[model samples]
Target: MRPAHLALAVLVAAVWGVNFTVIEIGLDRFPPLLFSALRFLAAAVPAVFLVGRPKVAWRWILAVGLVLGVAKFGLLFVGMDAGMPAGLSSLVLQIQAVFTALFAAAALGERPSRLGVTGMAVALAGIAVAAVDEGTTGPLTAFALVVAAAACWGASNVLTRRAAPPDALNFMVWVSTVPVLPLLLLSLWTEGPARDLEALRALDRQGAGTILYVAWITTVFGFGAWGLLLRRHPASTVAPFSLLVPVFGMTSAALFLGEPVTPLRWCAAVLLVGGVAVTSLAPRRGAPARRVDPDPAAADRAEVTPSR
Candidate 1:
């Protein structure tokens, strides 16, 4: 990869990492579900018109959208609002890789390599350490909610593999439209129509800015750049850059949110990030070694949601 492209990769990771704080900031103004609804609304609208529909059936798009957009993001924002620290939430959410591996084993009969299983075990143990630390550092409910989001993300990854849409960016943009109505309905139901109205009326510049950052910068630009980089280079070359996200997430959260990083928390971060790196970046044994272009859709689904 060129130095310029590498910088672009780092920039996208920074945007994604900082997004945890952005979501936290946005939630201060809009209720979680409503904020999420508006976020996707911003993501889908004009982009959908420009991108056109993906080649896959509408049902698949709807399926991926509901699971990825609504279920995963809804839980994520709600978790953050419930007191998941921005940096910690970013760290915890990477568990989706572990869950994805497990789900793929069961649902798709794609067996995990020994390295993958070991990496997941280390990652889970790290989560246990982080959870124990979080009991004092943050809300357990928040942690649990983020974990649930990771699970939903894992499920979405499986569904996406099953669907196997061509053109990931287009699929992502179009599927984004699927969640707008449902999330709005949910916002009205849980947040109450009156409160929802109040929240929208109360939206200040910060709230609006945060939503645009999430919608266009993180959701659109982050995924779009990643897909383009993958197209230009080998997955091995481009994919490893994702390891920088948690590093950026933690550092940015400390700077912006003043979230403390305890000694145990640092240890846990190392374990979790290292484990995920091993799980995602390691080569599998007994597999044919061939150079194939990474599937843009799979890459989109894998790194894309957590990048949210």
Candidate 2:
């Protein structure tokens, strides 16, 4: 990658890292589902107009949206709202990589390399440590919800690979369009019109603007830039940088939310980062060579020609 691209990647990581903080802020004012709905709505509208439609099957697009947008974010927000700490949420969400690897193996017929297996094991160990640290009293249910969110993300990865959108930008734009309505419906049904109206009416201008910022800058721009990076680089090259998210998340939470990062959690972070590195940095095995059919005319010409 060029220096410019590298810089952009760093910027994206920072944005995503701080996203937990942003979510915490937004949730203080709005319900989780409503906050998520508004975020997606903000992302989808201008994106639909500017990027237009992606050249993909409607089913695939919908699947992508349901998995990535509705399932992932919805579960994440719920988990956070249910008492999962923001710093912990950031760390736990990294489980998506493990889920993605497992899904790829199961759904795509891809075999895991030795390094991949090791990486996953290491990462899992880290998660176990984190879980222990979280303890039974600290909203185990919320943690489970985050794990569910990770599984949804993994499913989305498989769908995305299968769909193989012609362009990432178009794919993102189109898939992003799928989540708004479902999320709105969910918000209405669960949160109720009364609570929704109350929250909307009571929110100060600053809170409303924060939601808009979370939607446009964090969701749309962040994901758009991410899609662009994925299109330009190999997943192996790009995906590992996401490890920084928790690091940033922890730091941001400490600074902004007054959350503490204990020594044990720091150790867990090391194991997690190491595990992810082991899996991602390993060498890939060579694929079997493919045979090509000889041209009929060429074969005939060869038969007619004199032997050398």
Candidate 3:
């Protein structure tokens, strides 16, 4: 990677990492589901028109939007609001790499290598440790919700890989549009019309600013830059930068939100991130040793790391 591209990769990781805190900030003003709806709404509009047509089938786009946007993000924000700390939420979500491997095996008939299996075990063990740590200090239900969000992320990764759209950025923009209505309907139904209305009535500059940050900074620029990096370089070179997310997440949380990173949490971070590294990097034994497809969408099948 060129020095500039390396910096850009780090910048994207930082944006994604610190985004947890941004999400935490957003939740203070809007109900979780409603905030999520607006986040996607801001992300999709106008930009959707700019991204050109969706390169993949609508079904794939719809599947990803529902799973990644609705289920994953909806659960993540609600989990944070329910008491999952931003840093730990960031850490736990890394489990998506493990879940993606498992889902690929089941759905796409792609098997993990022996080392990949080992990495999955190590990563799950790390989650167990993190669970034990969170149980001592936070709501177990909240942690579970984030884990479930990771599963949704994994499911969506498989869909994205299968979609193999030539233009990753366009696919994501269209996917962003799919979640808006479902999330708003869900918010109205579950969060209650009164609560949603109250939140809208209460919106201020800080609230709106946070929404734009998550929507444009993290969702639009973050994913767009990431897709560009993937197009410019191999997935192996780019994927490793994602390990920095939790590091930034935990540090930023401590500095900004005053969330303490316990020693146990540190241990969990090491295990989780390290396991993810191994899982993500190890090549399957039977697959031919070859270059990743030059197309960004196809390259992402092996490794696609998106923002929080």
Best by lDDT: 3
Which prediction has more favorable lDDT, 1 or 3?
A: 3
Instruction: Please report, in order, the local distance difference test score of every candidate based on alpha carbons.
Output: 0.82, 0.74, 0.89
Q: Which ten residues in a row have the lowest lDDT in candidate 2?
A: 299-308
Error of 2 at 97 (Å): 0.7
| Per-residue lDDT of candidate 1, residues 100-127 (tens digit) | 7777778767677888888998889889
Considering lDDT, where higher is better, how would the candidates rank from best to worst?
3, 1, 2
At residue 224, give the lDDT of candidate 3. 86
Worst ten-residue run, lDDT, model 1?
A: 284-293
Task: Please identify which of the two predictions, 2 or 3, would achieve the higher TM-score against the true structure.
Answer: 3
In candidate 3, list every pair of residues with a backbone clash.
Answer: none
Residue 83's lDDT within candidate 3 is: 98
Residue 111, candidate 1: C-alpha displacement in angstroms: 0.8
lDDT of 2 by residue, 46-162 (tens): 778888656778999899899888999899998998888888888888777777777767766666788889889999998888877777438788888988998888788778767
Ranking the candidates on TM-score from highest down gives: 3, 1, 2
Top candidate, metric TM-score: 3
Alpha-carbon TM-score of each model against the true structure:
0.92, 0.88, 0.96
TM-score of 2: 0.88
